[model samples]
Target chain A: MNYNFHWRPVMKALPELLEAALLTLQVAALSMVLGVLIGLGLSLIRMHMKGPVRWLATTWVELARNTPALFQLFFFGFGLGAVGVHLTPYLIVLIALTFNNAGYLAENFRGGFKAVPDTQIRASRSLGMTAFQAYTRIVIPQVLRIVYYPMTNQMVWAVLISSLGMLVGFRELSGETQFFASKTFRIFEYFAITAVIYYVIVKIILGAASLLSKRLFRY
Target chain B: METTSRFFSGFTPNDLWFLAEAAGRTLWISILSIGFGTVLGVFFGWALSVTKTAGTLTIAPILDIFRSVPLIIQLVLFFNFAPMIGLRLSPFDAGVIILTIYTAALVSNVARAGIEAVGMPMRRSARSLGMSYWQDMRYVVWPIGLRAVFPSWIGVALGVMKDSALVSVLGYVELLKASQILITRTQDTLLILAIAGAFYFALSYPISLYASKLEERWSQ
Candidate 1:
């Protein structure tokens, strides 16, 4: 109740914070792209492949899903370093987020794949479509539609989890906020602004996602 | 061997004891938060369902703020802000308060969906049978709604349990923080992390498996 509130320092740092926000978006978007690609591959392998490969994919999905994201980031940061595989903080966060995103996205893709009936694939094949064509044109699009909402959610999750970059010393939005807050000791003002930035970012993502869904899924 | 001795100390049995105690704290905090959160969430959810427009205007947006922001940021903000407002809260207290609210925000949605899943006709029938409103809720709505949302509730609970790890950021010595301390002491990064991951998986995997199985059985 006695502490004086300061907005001036926060205002001075706003541009840098916004710049860091872009970095946050960039890393999140990159991770989501890589995650979706790898997730799709892992789901397909789990569906079609056998033996060690499928087991490896299952292990990846389960580990990602079951453990906390921060733990995974720490593993990438220090655990790998222990084995002499050094990574920059940016790479650590990127790899960790990608690892988490791919795991969760793989499960969503699996469910999506299952939701597409076997008969549809068989019918496409019977109509003289090649296996590749049956999958590419007939199945994948439907699976994408089924998974579109979850993918959007995962994208938001990637953005939220990227905030953990602060702990590893990566200068994402939260990290930059932490940096300035420590210097100015305007901890509340700095984080309060960061939270608003996050809220706005989330709203924009949801808004764009809904609009995109309209375009992509319009029947 | 020489390099190993220089860089890595033996992970003593005491470290295992330390982790187990920290694991207990993790469970205790999660349980406390989830318990309080669920009660508050169920009330909020009931209110949201019962008073749609008013609830949407008031409660829903506030709850949405909790949902939209990252938990870590929320933790940092609340931890820093509390002392400024003359509330002398410990990290543990602040962590619990914030986590409880976060959990409630999530659970409120699940609870509302569960309530909605119990159709109007079902409740009407109970009322027609001369049951009082509270009686009808207790007898008809509660059981059916619980079953409908049980898996989702489990998902939220497990999610919160994992998310409670974020509380470590506030300097609460939970399982993850304990392992960090151990890693620093032993420099056995891989070993300690593996053990911590295993502890998490052990706690999480069985419950998730059971939830999925229940969901499948319920769907059938």
Candidate 2:
């Protein structure tokens, strides 16, 4: 394939890409927090609740895990607007990502919970620990340790999946790349630079998470 | 309450049919895209595993490029650029191509892990049994490696299913696009969105459940 290479437009658009990357970082960080909270809540419900709540938790986990993150975003971002509710574009994007992240996070956390020895719970109960106290003191920390490694993967996914936020007009990195690509018609250059940015960001985050895991879990 | 009523009232029979039709398209697109992705993925996976120099050092940087490039950007490039280069493609074709490449990158990594997980002894023994390198790979290595990696492969498939929705932005009448159309027409936000989510759940939940079951059975 014959191609014309140009750097001038890409150079000019670097600022936009940087702005987009910043938004991407913001979205990913916020969504990771939200997803972790939602995941913890779902996992706890699955562990301690009965009947419908457990079923719902499992169902949510399956549905989110099975479906594409893009689909969830589209369903929430555009579909929500279809039925008459107009949430802020970013919030809609965040909600969709939160759900998607929660599904996988819940599964990871559930596995961690499973890894918590039954005897520990028994011991805690015998010591007059309430169910809440038992979970917080005896179960959650251990589960976090078990789940930490996978949390790194999920966190990376959070960063990657944040690109879909662009689809709903969130103006994240990918969206900014597209904006530059369309503006200058330098598609490859725009995409190539942003792609590198993404890889670097992911690598840095994963490295940081791994270091943090070592410190926090010491394993 | 008024807002909720309006949202609930948005679904007409035509809208239901529209969604069903869209679901059919979504399924067709997903199947086709995943099929291409699976083959290309396995091939790239094999390439990454066997070709020591390319596999170890070079392929990863290239694969990193592919993985980090957003699917939407890739699709846009194919959608907008293909026609300019005398490679006219329908939106569906473009979508499939984009997904295939993206999913292939995923498959490559997962498949490489699977192959590596099979360990060195298996390869050595197969070679000692007078098997050619290609023969050993085809007969002994792939079957076991792929089976071991099936859970992860399914995870990639799940990811592909989700990413396929991005094709809707290119105006393919996939499930999400259909919902977008309904939303624009009816102006009901919550009910239609919830219904769309239910439809997505319908599409995805079974595959996930089956994958979970398969993971359990395989690991056992």
Best by DockQ: 1
Residue-wise C-alpha lDDT for candidate 1, range A1-219, written one tens digit per residue:
788889999999999999999999999999999999999999999999999999999999999999999999999999999999999999999999999999999999999999999999999999999999999999999999999999998999999999999999999999999999999889999999999999999999999999999998889
* Number of backbone collisions per candidate: 0, 7
Local error of candidate 2 at residue B187 (angstroms): 3.3
In candidate 1, how many Å is residue B152 off?
A: 1.2
lDDT of 1: 0.95
Q: Which stretches of candidate 1 lie over 4 Å from their true place?
A: B1-8
Give the runs in model 2 whose Cα sits over 4 Å from its true position.
Answer: A1-6, A79-85, A123-138, A178-189, A217-219, B1-15, B83-86, B126-139, B188-195
Error of 2 at B3 (Å): 23
Candidates in order have lDDT scores of: 0.95, 0.81
